[model samples]
Target: MTWFLISIAALIGGYFIYGTFVEKVFGINEKLATPAHAQNDGVDYVPMSTPKVYLVQLLNIAGVGPIFGPIMGALYGPAALLWIVIGCVFAGAVHDYFSGMLSVRNNGASVPTITGRYLGNGAKHFMNIFAIILLLLVGVVFVSAPAGMLTNLANEQGGLEISKTTMVVAIFAYYIIATIVPVDKIIGRFYPLFGALLIFMSVGLITAVGFSSEHTIMGGYAISDMFTNLNPNDMPLWPALFITIACGAISGFHATQSPLMARCMKNEKNGRFVFYGAMIGEGVIAIIWCTLALSFFGSVDALSDAVHNGGPGNVVYSSSFGLLGTFGGILAFLGVVILPITSGDTAFRSSRLILAEYFNMEQKSLNKRLLMAVPLFVIGAILTQVDFGIIWRYFGFANQSTATIMLWTAAAYLLRHNKLHWICTVPAVFMTTVCIAFIMNNATLGFGLPMTISTTIGIVSALAITAYVVKVSKGKGDTELADEEKPKSAPETV
Candidate 1:
């Protein structure tokens, strides 16, 4: 339990120390008008309270990723905890903060639009298609999983029964409403309640584990064991663990979620509490699930066996039900169900916003909103019919790749203003290498090169990219004074 407590404290401390420093580095100006107020459309860019934005952003980024990802990461033994702490503080939270605050500075432009300003049109265009495809994948997969679970639950109950198709239609209906409605109408009012359920689920499970008489969940974590990959299947921790635990540690998907909340934020200063703090909140949930998986089944080997047999979904269901009784089980199940559904709605919403921003179209009209939203759902419905197993594997790489690019974007933002750019530059380099080596060494993705060759190539690629970014960024320093107070016009360029 010591390591678990330590991980929890580290995540909390990250918000105060590192989070505050990042906020200062970017320089928040409360006196400046935000997008929500400057361009209040009531549909998407409406001002909202800091607390409400925090909860909505939290649910927006967190799908079932944190829960299921870490449980699978737990198969690597104590290594998962170390990554969750270090990666959350240094990489994930920092990426999220910039993704949101940068949007705020640029008048709530979408990620691709902002990427264009810093990285160039090529990146912007690539990210435009990249983000849309990833979001569509997320929306479709989330719908099918929950629909299947709900179908089973409904059928099992004594007198009632439901088909997967019926559940699918019902879920799709909610997604459309959530996607098309005003920010205040559906998301603002209902997300807080969903967020409450999520918090309760995490808190209750941790409480149960803390008071349990089972072997200390954290006792297995030793310094010697920290670097070792104890994955029963022998998957390398270098890339596999990093990719497996993306959401809890550092995920590109969260960066996409950030701009959604950036449009609603009332103050620039709230970026720390809403974006950075929310990532830490996800880290805590991840740590809890990692700890439970490592101990609840007696050993990491046992957890691996369970995972191989039925996947992480089964592990989550069985662990929650076993640890907490029937009532708690139901809540745990709902929490799992609610997670993907909440994120699914926002995935569609973000896609709509991205399309609107890309085409320079006004979104205040219902027809305009539908014009952007309908095609996305039509595509999503079609995707739900196809087998997504292989496609799903690519999301991890795409997510980390997007995050690597975002980190460089943040570093470029700092460099252009003559502030410290090393903060993002370092993690961006690290993740860039990870992404390179991962696909190269894996047979299914790349050429399945030898480990030594892949690692060497990854390092060379990182150095080349770092050199290019620094060279281009020099002599582009905008006056920090005016830049911070008024900021640059990002959306206008689009």
Candidate 2:
């Protein structure tokens, strides 16, 4: 499932790039272009090629969540892969693509702004509140997962307790660089190189595990045995699956990425490539991580032991690096550190943009800094204390709920415009149904109803938003709608 998804994502990413450059040939005029507003002269608003945007999007979306979520989700047997792939293509990617394209068309507005435009002021308010809640949940879980990874690395490599202070310092340093560096330059020069190294390391690790003579089982029983034999007291399938998808599937963080990248697009026609394209890439990465986990560990029982006795990061490192020699293990460790830095940078920048827009503050102003500091500090403190595995589950659920709502909004918009066929509506429908099913499963299995409750509320909100958008589209004929804004023409080479 992991390899299949990654392959699809890579193809989509490539297609999106090709499509972006060919927009003129497609007769997509300036009228359909993404509008630019509140443009930043700094790092956030730099215009980048479709490929670069895709890389940033991929890096931002592919983080520790995918690694942990699928490994844990595997406890439900291979049955869980059904939800991950279905959700990724339909619910997850669709929500990301459309939300991004819509935001671009509306002057790089965040999801809340787009929701307000089509849904109504009330829907906007609800979406904003929901988005923020979801963001915090995501931040908390992501933060802890990486920190735990580092702790485990320190324990294994040095046989010493890793200080929270060292982790905090490392995080702070990464964020400082992320804030100062230009994303375009980073993507163009470093992203692909870094990506290549990571892939090579991953391939090496996967090869090692495949050839190992230790504990081999026939007909995939080794994988199945891992799940069936897990400690009975651990969280059960229904809730675990829900949590897994939530962390790995569609997330609110994508909402932030969509709008930021939308502003970089040269025209509206690039939407299919940039928005949908990057999502497919992310799905593929998720697949790779999943495959690595299953093939390397051979059982959920082994994975759980690593997490409990050694730590989750140990499970990851031991699995990926254990296959390689000491050098390979160290490489895996560095990659893990780099992964979070890339993701954290994107998240922080997006969070800053969203907060600045919401409060109508200057991007670099002291007020914006003050507003962001509290959330960042609070999130950091939470990471220092919480059990990341549980937090990841919550984050996954909240993210899927948000994606479910966004998909409904996109579907309604497309249907109203009679562009439903062009849009990826099939994926949208699948995501919505699966998310609801997972939510229902969670409820029946006695997981606290918080995530399910949020999802249920999102379903209601999506319905209301869709109805409102349709009503508005009817009132103002589609032909009368304003043209989407476009960027100024690029200068010709001398």
Candidate 3:
């Protein structure tokens, strides 16, 4: 309980301290016109209230990642609490704030376009393909998971009897509408309500945990036990815990989603609240759900057993419905069903904007919007037919891989500007090593080499990249700056 409280306080306190410091470093200039005001298309680039933008951005990034990832990561023990608090305060929130502000400063360019400017044209092209693929996987997976859950819920209730196929079609229809319409129309209006549900669910769980007399649920294995993996499966703490808890910690997907809000923000000052503050809010939510999962089951062993018996979704269902009864059922429905559906729609929406920016196509007209969206949704619909497990496994890898790119790109941007480049550079190097280690050590992809060899390679690769970055920064500072801001034009040789 002490560990949990400390983690909660750290996340909250982080916003005022580290979050504010980051805001200062970025130097928000409210007098400057944002992309929303500079290019108000009404369709995509529409200014919104800061609160609305914050809520949308929070829900957009949160989705199922923070909740589900932490639940699984909890199997590794309380190491998750440490990661959520530390990573959210430093790496994840900083990554998000910089991503959003950089986009706002550069006319709401997508992550790939931004990467092209700071990294190079070659890196940019690669990120373009990677971001699109990751987004499609996210859209398809979020769509299938929620639709299947909703179908099951309906079946269990013995009521309206919506088939999984029908739910997919209905959900996809909502996605299409959300994608094609103006930013302020469907998304702006409905997301606040969905955001309310998300917050309420967390509040309910936190209250239940706080008031409960069952210390057994909260006892056993202090937070320090998390330093070593306690999983019965003996999963490595390095890459497995990092990837499993991506949202609560750090995720490249948030960088992609940041531009969506960047285009809608009314002030640069709001970047701190919308991007950094939202990540902290997500950390709080993750802490609530993670602690609740452990407390509800009375032990990490029981929680792991529940996860093995069904999946994260079953754990979500059991914890919510089983604990809170009918109220819990409603919260479970929102967690297992509604939240992912919201994220799924926005995933497609972000994909549309990304493709538009990539092709230098105008999206002011409905025809142009449909032209970009139709093929994407068609592909997403087709992907929905694929196995969810395969898509999820690939997504976990792809998500962190994307984050590694964003961190390095951000580091490069800072280096070119002669700011404290290490802010982004250090985390970038660490995550680069993690990504390499994951690919080299995972059972499916590599030889499943010994940890010693994998760690050695990871360290060497990370140092090599960091040294290259430092070497490049000195000679090409001005050249890099010239390329950093111009997204549509081909990048200058650095």
**Number of the predicted model whose TM-score against the real structure is largest:** 1
What TM-score would every model get versus the actual structure? Answer: 0.95, 0.79, 0.94
Better of 2 and 3 by TM-score: 3
Model 3 Cα displacement at 103 (Å)? 0.3
Model 2 regions lying over 4 Å from their true place? 1-40, 158-161, 180-190, 213-242, 247-249, 267-273, 307-311, 364-375, 421-480, 485-494
Q: What is the descending lDDT order?
A: 1, 3, 2
lDDT of each: 0.86, 0.58, 0.82
Inter-residue clash pairs, candidate 1: none
Cα-lDDT of candidate 3: 0.82
Q: Residue 174's C-alpha lDDT in candidate 2?
A: 62
TM-score, predicted candidate 3 vs. hidden true structure: 0.94
What is candidate 1's CA lDDT for residue 394?
75
Q: After superposition, how far is residue 485 of candidate 1 from its true place, in Å?
A: 2.9
Flag regions of model 1 displaced more than 4 Å. Answer: 156-160, 214-216, 219-223, 479-484, 487-494
Expressed as tens digits, the lDDT of each residue in 42-120 for candidate 2 is 4556566666666666666666666666666655555555556665654566677677777765667788777766656
Please provide, for model 1 over 221-272, each residue's C-alpha lDDT reduced to its tens digit, 9 standing for 90 to 100.
5777767788888788887888889988998988788998999988777889
